[model samples]
Every structure is written in C-alpha cells, then in structure tokens.
Target chain A: MRFSIQQPALLHMLQVVSKAVAVRTPKQVLTGILLEADDNTLTTTAYDLELGIQDTIHSDDTNQLDVSTPGSIVLPARYLSEVIRKLPSDNVSISVNNNYMTSIQCGQVEFHLHGIDAEEFPKLPEFQSDTQIQLQSELLNDFIRSTTFAASNSEVRPILTGTHIQYTDGTLNFTATDGLRLATRSTTFDDADTHNWTAIIPSKSLSELSRLLPDNDTVIDVQLTDSHSLFVIGETYFYTRLIDGTYPDTSRIIPKVQRTEIRVNVKSIASAIDRAALIARDRDNHMVRLEVQGQKMTFSSSSPEIGNVSESVEASQKEGDDFQIAFNAKYVLDALAVFDNTDVLIRFNGSNQPFTIQQVDGDVGLQLISPVLMR
Target chain B: MRFSIQQPALLHMLQVVSKAVAVRTPKQVLTGILLEADDNTLTTTAYDLELGIQDTIHSDDTNQLDVSTPGSIVLPARYLSEVIRKLPSDNVSISVNNNYMTSIQCGQVEFHLHGIDAEEFPKLPEFQSDTQIQLQSELLNDFIRSTTFAASNSEVRPILTGTHIQYTDGTLNFTATDGLRLATRSTTFDDADTHNWTAIIPSKSLSELSRLLPDNDTVIDVQLTDSHSLFVIGETYFYTRLIDGTYPDTSRIIPKVQRTEIRVNVKSIASAIDRAALIARDRDNHMVRLEVQGQKMTFSSSSPEIGNVSESVEASQKEGDDFQIAFNAKYVLDALAVFDNTDVLIRFNGSNQPFTIQQVDGDVGLQLISPVLMR
Candidate 1:
C-alpha cells in the first residue's frame, strides 16, 4: 500500500477514530486501527468489540492524491497518532511492503512500524436496521450532555449504566438514572412514523460521540437494530452494542405534585452550595441542607470536626410554603451544571422527598435527585 | 483575631503561604495557618518544620482598618482557602470569639471554623545572620529552573535531592546532580563580600518558591543562618531548612575537552528527539541514538517488538570528527527545555563519555549527560 496525504488531515481523522481503540484487550490486534487506502479515499476504522468508529478522508477532493497500490493494514493507534502529530512536515507519505513493514515519512522525519494484517482485525458490525432517525447534531449533543452523567458508574445493575433512548408517537426521549438521581430529556420530531424503537445505549458510547460532535448545525443520521445502534455524522460512523437488560420505569418516581417551589439564579445558588460543600465534604455523606423562607434560600452544612458553614442567595420568585431539604452536594452541583441559563426552577415535594430542577423557561429537560434523611 | 480585609487579597495571601501547611502531620495544629490581626495589619503564617511561609496584608495602606480586638488563631489551611475563594463578596470579615471559634463573613455567606489555640503552633526559626545579600528575583528563579530538574527524586542519596548553592570569589553557583546527569548555573555578583556561604536547599522548596516568584525585575532580600535561609520579597517571607549532607564533586564529570561539536536549532533537534522518543519510550531504557555526520544529525530509536524510527535534521555548523552516542531521550529533552535561545551547542567527548549542552548565546548554564551503552 502506498499513499501520500496531508499531515493535519490524516492526524485529525486518526484522532477521531482512535477513541474507540481498546486500552487493554487480550487480542493485541484489537488495540490497533485498520487503515485502508484505495484510489482517492483513505478510511480508518477502530473497534473494541463493544464500540467502533470509522472515519474517511477524501484526498482527491481535499488535496492531492497519489496512490500506486490499494491495500489495508492495522497499526497501533497511540503510536501512529503520536508520530503523525509530531511529524515536522505538512505532508506525510506512507507505504507498506510485503512483509507488513510500513514506512511513514514527513520532511526530515521517518517512522517504521510493524503492522498487523488487516484481515486479522475484527470487522465492524454492519447496520441492518429498518428504523432510521435524523436529527440536528446540536440536539443530539444536548441529549447526551443532559442525561449521561446521571447514569450509574458501576456495572452491578448493568441496565442502569446505559441511557434509555426511545422514539414513540413523534417524540424522542432519553433517560438515565442511577437510582439516586435521574436525568430525562425529550424533543418532538417533525416526521412521525408508525414504528416504535427503543434502545439502551451505554453512556460511555454516547460520551465518545459527544466529544466528536460538531458545533455547527449539521444533520446526523441514526440507524438502529435490535442489538446494535449506529450514528452517522458527516464522513464518520459510530456503532455500539446495546445493553442486554430492560431499563426500569422511572415515570412513577417523579413527583406528581409539588408543595413548594423556588426560582433562583443558577450561578448564585450553585456558588452557595459549593461553599457549603467545602464543609460537608469532610463528613461521611457529603450532605448539605437548604432552607427557603420568603425570597431567601439559605444553604448550610456542618461537620463535627470541620465546623459549619452557611450562605444565602435570594430567590427570584417563590411559591407555596417555605421548606427545608437535605441532599448530597455533588449531585445538586452536577444537575446545575447542565443548565446554560441564568435561572433554574427547583420544585420540592417535601422534606426527605425527591426534588426536580429544570430550566426556568423550558421543560424539555429535568433532573431529579432524592433527598437524604436528616439525622 | 478580628479584621475586615479584601477577599481577593486575603485569598491570594492564604494560597501563597498555605503551601507550607502539612497535610497529614502528627500535630493537628501544623495543618493550619496562624492568622494574627493587629492595629494595621493582618499576618498569616504556616510552618511545616522543613519549610515556613509568612505573609502580611496591610489594611491601613490598601483599605479601611476596623479591628476591635487583636488576637491570633490557627485555621485549617485547605478549608480556609476554599471558603475565601468561594465567598461572594469582595470584603471578608473575620473575627474570633472567646472560645477560639472563628467566624468568617462575606456578604450573605458565613463560615464558622473551629480554630486551634495559636500557642500550640510551632514558631518559625529566626534568621540571625548578619551577612545579607540582595539579588533580582529573575536571577534567583532562573537559577532554580536550570538546576532543579537534575536533582535526585529519591532520598537514598539525600544531598543529591538538594540543589547545592555556593557564593565564592564573587560568583554565585548552583549545581544539582543525580549521578546520571548534572546541571550547573552561575552568575557573577558585583558586590564582593568577604563572607562566603554554601548551602543545599531542598529542590521541593525551591520549586514551590519558583512557582510564586514574580516575573518582573523585583529585588529580593536573602538572609542565611546556620541551618536555615530566609527570603523576603515585599511583605512575604519564605524560609526553608538547609540539607545537612555535603554535595559530591561533579566538576570532574563534565568533559573539559570535546572531540566532536555540533550546533543546531534548538526547536529542530528537540522536535526530532521528541518523535524518536515515541518508539524508544516502549523500550526498557527509553534510549535514543544521535549520529552526527558532516552537517546532518540523525536521531533514531528502535524496539525489537515495536519496530524502529529515524529522523535527521541539518546542523548549522560542525567541527572535528563525526560520532554517534546513545542517551535517555527524556534526560536530553529535559536539558533542552531550559534553553531560551533558538540555537544550542552540543559537545561530545567520545562514544560513552559525558557530553555537555549549553546555550549558544551565553555560558551561564550548562547541562551534562552520560551516554548509555549500546546493546
């Protein structure tokens, strides 16, 4: 195989696909990326059994392409990326001999790496699905950002480690929960179909795609099968295996009624909670109490050994009876971070009950965290 | 202690001095910073036996002074710093009650911390030296940056972990070595004092000070005692205990004569070495070979299992015979990072002998590294 490519273009493509490379795999070839150069297009693919990524670069349209032979090989992702990034020249020339010894040259620098036969690398699963959905990249990115963090970090309850995604009646919903907290986001689709599809995607896969999502308003096409899902963005393809269990029904857990509600500036309340957390962090449960009276919300925490701290921020608006509640400070902070707006509406059912926080002006996304019983 | 000070000012002072706080000391009071408020100033001090820092904030000169009572108390450094940084107001009011309970208030925020009795805190050692010298902070910081990296990270040889500093014959010399490599820097002081002094300051202490040193050309006063040294910059005082062991003689290891010399652009060679390091890093020794032939210098490294890589760059000038030598790429990279100039002079004595690297423009700082035997 012989190919000449622009260094930056190749480096960017390699970086986008290398995210799927397995860090520790029993099979050494699983940690490599399959590079195939044919005609005017070069494709890079990486699969780690559970997740896979494929990105293609067109040399003919983008720049110059001189390919004497068309072939494929698998190279270690990390070493290849490093060499490509550190090369001294703008253009890099790569060629492979019959012995699978690849030579990469750029200006005054050259690197020779032993490549595994591409046939030995596992191929990405083909997308064989009739259900197809198209959405804006921005919308997809927001869905991942809002729901993924609440997913369980442990694998004891395998289903809880994934984000439940469902499309029904022209509406798309994504929910993630770890029993302690749940994040749910929904948006209505323009095109309605008779088909109802649901899938539980591991949070790790969504996070990798989120990192590579473009900021521009590009359209992303998603295809789903019974056991696998695929996301196609521009010249890139991302595929991941679905979790094998059913997600728990979380609708009954959300409070049907709220006795008290408070609207406060997100930054003000977040900072108050942060300071109170400094004291609570030394305690066993990292708990902080919040009390609302009139328009002032007081945040406080106390540790027998570290002392106590209290801070109050004025609520923009208040309703119903004044209330007091206790919660893990970190959970509240994580919920607050998703909001890009100035104000957030916080609804409380009662002390020791779960509370819901949502954007002040919108109800598309909401976070619910169960309160800790005060000792 | 009672004082109303600017929050940012107090926070900055605490951060600078808090580095000396012992995180897990046997004596609990050693984990706190002693705060003393007087008629016109608020002083903060932290001593960890080996290192001490004291900083004073003048209220009369910068802001209004309203101290109803003058007292001293010790507050936990990490908690205090975090609270101060997160406070919402610009001015922070601190007051100690009769029971040594400290109240810190800023705007709508208040923190109550249980403080230790200031009497239990250890006092910083006094500097009783009559011979004092003043030097530019820039010069002091440069001396530290050039020599500290060569200091041994292990405590097996205690003296090698400290940077040896000596003032002799109007020249101030700083040297550090870990047996494998040595770095030395010196500058002539204009004031010829008859009193000569030598001390080994712990690299950790110097590194901490280097992080806080100002970039401007400010004069810093230095005072030396039998076992301690004090540095005063404005209202801040930094004290560190001197290492007790004698430094080894490293002058003899630096080659006085060279058989081969090469001058190259620092960036060009450093980048080449960085690329070569990608392959060598997987090897046991992380060794890279440099071969100088005519005006071109080739950098190469190989791993039996991972393959090999080589890159060559043109040298600006060359003298004597061409030679090839192998050394740890990391050590060479560390030595090259200290040069601020575009060009560097690399001198080689023989295949296995130590070589020197110095800035092409100046002779102040020099680095010597011994070659690794080829397999």
Candidate 2:
C-alpha cells in the first residue's frame, strides 16, 4: 500500500478508532489498527471482540490524498500515533515493502515500522435492524451523562452495570440503578419510529461514544438489535455488543409521597456539605446530617475520635413538617450536580426511607437516594 | 492562644513550614506544627529531625495581627491546612482551651481540632559563624536547576546524591555527577570573604529551597557550618543538615583535547534526537548515533525487533576530522536543556572518549557525557 494523506485529517480518524484497541487482549493482533487505502479513500478499523469502531476519510475536492496502490496493513496503534504526532511536515507519505515493513516519510524525518498482515485481524460483527431511531448528538450525550454515573461498577451484578434504554410514545428514556440510588432522564424525539425496542448498553461504551460526539446539533442514526447496537455519525460507525440480561424494575423504588419538602440553593448546600464531610471522613459511613426548621437549614457531622463541624445556610421555603435526616455526602453531592437550575427541591418521606431530588420546577430528571440510619 | 489573622497570610506561612513536617516519624509530635502568638507576632515552625523551618509574621504597620493572650500550641499540620483551606471567612479566629484543645472559627463555620502540647516539640539548632555568604535568590535557583539533574539517586553512593558547593577566590561553584555524566555551574561574588569552605547539600533540600525562593532578585543570607546550612530570606529561616562524605575528583575525568567540534542549532538537534529516541526505547542503553560529516549531521537509532528511524539537521560549522559517536539520548537531551543560546558547541575527543556540551560563547556552565561502546 502507498498513500499520502494530510496529517490533521488522518490524526483525527486514528484517534476516533484507537479507543477500540485492546489494552491487553488474548488475541495479539487486536492491539493493532487495520488500515486500508483504496479508490481515493482510507478506512481505519479497530475491534476488541466486544467493541468495534470503523471510520473512513475520503479525499475530495477540498482535501488532498494520492493513492498509487490499493492494499491493507495493520500497524501498532501506539507507535503509529506517536510517529504521526512527531512528524515534521503537514503531509505524511507511507509505503509498504514486500516484507510488510512500512516506511513513513515526512520532510526531513523518516520511520520504518514493522506491521502485521491485515488478513490476521478479526472481522467486525455485522449489525442490522429494521427499526432505526434518530437522535440529536447533544441530547443523546446529555442523557448518557445524567444516568450513567448511577450504574454499578462491580461485576457481581452485570445487568446493573449497563444503562437501560427504551422508546415509547415518541420519547427516548434512560435509566440506571445501583440498588442504592436510581437515576432517570428522558427527552422527546418526534422523529422516532413507531416500533418500540429496549437494549441494555454497557455504561463504558456509552461514555466512550459520548466523548466522540460532535459539538453541534447534527442528527445521528442509531440502530439497536438483540445482540448489538450501532451509532452512525458522519463517516464514523461505532458498534458495541449488548449486555444479555434483564434490568431490575426500578420504578417501584422511587418515593411516591413526601412528608417534608425543602428548597435550597444548590451551591450553598453543596459547599456546606463539603465542609462537614471533611470531619465525617473518619467515620464509618461518611455521613452528613441535615436539619430543617423554619427558614433555616443546618448541616453537621461528627467523629468521636476527632470533633464535630456544623454550618447553616438559608432555605427559600419549607413545607410539611420539620425533619432531620442523615445521608452519604457523596450521593447527595452527585445528585445535586445534574441540575442546571440555581435551586433544587429535596423531598423526604421519613428519616429512614428513600428521598427524591429534582429540579425545583421540572420533573423530567429525578434522582432517588436511600438515607442512612443514625445511631 | 487567641488571635485573628488574615486567611491568605496564615495559609502562606502554613504551606512554607508544612514541607518540613514528617509524614511518619518515631517522634509523633514532629508531625504537628508549633504555633506561638505573642504580643505582636505569630510564629510557625515544623521539624523533621534532619530539616527545620520557622517563619514569623509580625503585626507591623502594613500587616494586621491581633493577639489577646500570649501562648503556644501544636496542631496536626495536615488537618490544620485542610481546614484553613475550606474556611468560609476572610479572617480566621483561633483559640486554645485549658486542656490544649483548639477551636478554629471563620464566619458561620467552626471546627474543633485536637492539639499536642507545645513543650514536646524539638528545638532548632543554632548556627553562629563570622563568615557569611550573600546570594541572589534567582542566581542560586539557576545554579540548583543546572546541576541537580546530574545527581545520583541511589543510596549506595550517598556522596554522589548531593551537590558539592565551594567558595574560593571570590567565586562560588557547584558540581554534581552520577558517574555517567557531570555538570558544573558557577558565579563570581565580589563581596565574598577570604575564608574558604566546602560542603555537600542533599539534592532534596536544594529542590525544596529552590521552590521557596522568590521570583525577583532578592539578596538572601547563607551560613554553612560543619553540621548544617542555613538560608534566611525575609522572615523565613530554612535549615538543612549537610551530607558528610568525600566527593570524587571529577576534574580529571574531563578530556583535555578535542578531535572534532560541531556547532548546531539547539532546537533542531533536540527535536531530531527526540524523534529518534522513540524508536530506540527498546534497546538496553537507549543509544542514538550522531554522524557529523562536513556541514550535515544525521541522527539514527534502530532495533532488530522494531524498525529503524533516522533524521538529518544542518550544522553551522565543523572542525577537525569527521566523526560518528553514540550516547544515551536522554542524557544528551538533558544537557541541551540548560543552554539559553540558540546554538550549542559539542566537542569530542574521539568516538570512545567523553564529550563536552556548552554554549558557544561562555565556559561558566559545562556538561560532559561519556559515550557508549558499540558492538
């Protein structure tokens, strides 16, 4: 294979597909990226058995690409990336010899890298489906960010480590729960088809796709099957295998009735809890307690070995009954971070039950956290 | 002790002394910072047995320090620093109870921290010498930066892990070597006394002192005794124990004749070597060869498992016979970093002898590296 491509364009495509390169895979060939240059285009692909990515860069009127011969080769991802980053010119010329050794020349510097035969690389699994869903890249990225953090990271419960997605009534919904905390985020999509489907995607795959999403409001096509899912954005095709299991029913866990409701500025309460949490670090649960009475709210935590710390912040309004509850400081902080509004409403059913946190005026994004029992 | 101090001022003093606090010491009290608030001054001190630092902040015309009672107490350095960083007010109020428990209050937030008795803290050693040296903080910092990288980090040769300092004939000199490479930097101080002395300061201490030095050119007092060296700047007093041993005679190791000398642009050569070094990482010595013939220089490195890489750059001038030499790329890169001149002159005796790297115009700073033997 012989080809000359622009450095920036090639670098971007390499970065997009490089995420699928396995760190330490049983198959040694999976550590390299397959590159094929044919008919005024270069295609790059990487697969690690569970996840695969393929991106194509076409040489058109605006870009310059010259291909004298069409062939394929697999080069080590790390070495190729580092060499491209250190090249001295704007354009890179690469050619492969009969022995499968590739020569890369740019300005005054040249590198010869040993490459594996492209035929030895495993082929990417084919994904097909009759129903396709359309989503704005920004909105899909937002849904992943809001719910994925609540997913369990342990391998004991494999189903809980994936984000559950469903389509109903022209709305796309996402939910994730770790048995202790549940988060749900949804957005209306009028362009979605009438066919309803559900798939549990590993949280790790969704995060990587979110990072590769473009910064504009372009619409992308998504296809979900029983065994895999595919996301098509421009010339890039990202695919990940579906986690085969049933997610627990989390709708029954959200609180229905509240005995007390308090509205406080998000920044004010978050900072107050942060200070109290410092003293609570030496404790068993890292718990911080909140007491709401009249127009005042006080946050405090203590350790018998050290000492106690307390601070008070003003509450906008309070209803129902005055109450005190203890909670894991990190859970409360994580729930408070998703809201863009200045104030958030936290509802409590009792001192020992689960509570709900959401935006002060909207119910679209809701988070439920189970309170800790104080001794 | 009861006093109110500005938050930034207190934080600065705490950060300076905290560096001397031991992480895990047999003397548990050494982990706490001793605090003494007198009529118009607040003093903070920390000692790790080998190193001690004391800084004083006086309530003079420009700074405000209020002391209602004169007393002293010791508080855990880490906890105190963290609490002071998270306080909510601009001024911090601190008071000690009869039982030595300390209360810290800032605005609406308050913390009670456990404290140790101040009487158990170790006292700093006093150094009194008639001969004193004055150095500009910037100049001293430059000297430390140029030589410290050559110090050996192994404990087997403890003497090579320290920088040798000598004051003779109105000039101060510094030298450090790790057997493979040597670096020396010096400056002439016209006000120096006739008394001559030599001492080896641990590289760790010089690094810490360099960090505390002011950015501007401020004159600081320095005193060296048989056991310790003291550096006094403004209100801060820093002391470090001297390393006791005999340093090797490195002067004889430098070659006296040059068979070939080449001058090349520093940036061009450094970047070329950096690129070549990437391919040389798999080798045992990480060796890169420089072949200088006439006006052109070529840098190349290769491994049998990985392929080869080569690059060429122009040299301004070359004298004597053409030569090819191999050396550790990292050592050559490090020596090139200390020169401010656009071009550096490299002098070589032969392919097997040591080479010297320095600015083309001056001899005050010099670095020598021994070449690697090729098969």
Cα RMSD (angstroms) for every candidate in the order listed: 1.8, 2.3
Query: Candidate 2: which stretches are off by over 4 Å?
Result: A60-63, A192-194, A362-364, B60-64, B192-194, B362-364
Expressed as tens digits, the lDDT of each residue in A1-375 for candidate 2 is 999987777788789999999889777789988999998999999988788899998896444777889999998888888888887648789889867899988888889989889999998777667877888898888888888888899989999999999887777789988877888988766764458888999989998899888867888789877899999988999989989988788888887889988888888888888888888874457799988887688899887656678888888988888888998898878877877658888888878899988887765488888888887
- What lDDT score is found at residue B294 in candidate 1? 96
lDDT of 1: 0.88
TM-scores, one per candidate:
0.97, 0.95
Report the C-alpha lDDT of model 2 over B15-104, residue by residue, as the tens digit.
Answer: 999889989977778999999999999999998978888999998544467888888999989888888887764888899986788888
lDDT of 1 by residue, B1-375 (tens): 788887778888899898899988788999999999888887899999999999987776455546668989999998898888888547788998867889999888899999999999998988777766888999999889989999999999999999998988788899999889889999886676536788899999999988878877899888888788898988999999999977888778888889988898988888989999999964456799998889989999998777799989999999989888899999999999988658988999878888999988976599999889876
Query: Model 1: how far is B96 from its true place, Å?
Result: 1.2
lDDT of 1 by residue, A13-103 (tens): 8899988999998899988989999988899999999999999877664546566689899998888988898885477889997678899
Docking class of 2: medium
Model 1: CA > 4 A from native: A60-65, B60-65
Q: Which pairs of residues have clashing backbones in candidate 2?
A: none
